[model samples]
Target: MTSLTRAEIGALGEQLAVEHLRTLGLVVLDRNWRCRYGELDVIAADDATRTAVFVEVKTRTSDRFGGVQQAVTPDKVRRLRRLAGLWLAGQDKGWAAVRIDVIGVRIGRQRTPEITHLQAVV
Candidate 1:
């Protein structure tokens, strides 16, 4: 069997996350939106709450050291907060709510991607 390349793994994880969000009825607006300052993986709208969601996708092949969610530390949250704010500021209008989310993905041989949804990660 061929070991998965980093890009392939990332693509799989992102695809899964997007699919899951769509299944949950969120309207996907953007993917991999980046600027010179930072990156936002996925942007979606939760119509139920009339809110905007900015997602960060974290992928891991193994959890022996730490899980994917563990990688998001306080520093990461701070950066995400700043980036999200920057994104919001650049937009034409404002929403009632804004959220920062993290999607944890773990892929392994003979198994599908394991996912963890962390809402309001910042």
Candidate 2:
């Protein structure tokens, strides 16, 4: 078995997150959206709720250092919240509600990837 690179792992995690969000009825508006401050991993819309969601994805091969979710620190959550505002400023239409979310992906040997989605993180 071969190990994936950091970029590859992150890409896989984001893709999986998008798929999972879509399954939950969210329409993906963008991925890897960047601004002068930082990047937003995923931006999606919950049509039913008229809400815009900003998602941060963290991928890890193991929990030796920390769990994938632990990677999203308070500072990171704050940054994501700011980035969400920046994203909205660039949008033509307004959303009824906005939220920040975190998606943790863990890939282990001989096992399917594990995904955890935490909404309204910030």
What is the C-alpha lDDT profile of model 2 across 1-122, one tens digit per residue?
68778999889988999999999999999999998999999999999989999998988787876875678889988888889999999889879999998888888743788898888876
Q: Could you give candidate 1's per-residue lDDT for residues 36-64 as a string of tens digits?
A: 88888899999888899998888788777
lDDT of each: 0.85, 0.89
TM-score of 1: 0.91
Which numbered prediction scores highest in TM-score against the true structure? 2
Q: Report residue 11 deviation for candidate 1 (angstroms).
A: 1.5
State the displacement of the C-alpha of residue 44, model 1, in Å, after optimal TM-score superposition: 1.0
Q: After superposition, how far is residue 21 of candidate 2 from its true place, in Å?
A: 0.4
Model 2 scores worst on lDDT over the 10 consecutive residues at: 62-71
How does candidate 2 fare on TM-score? 0.94
Models 1 onward score TM values of 0.91, 0.94
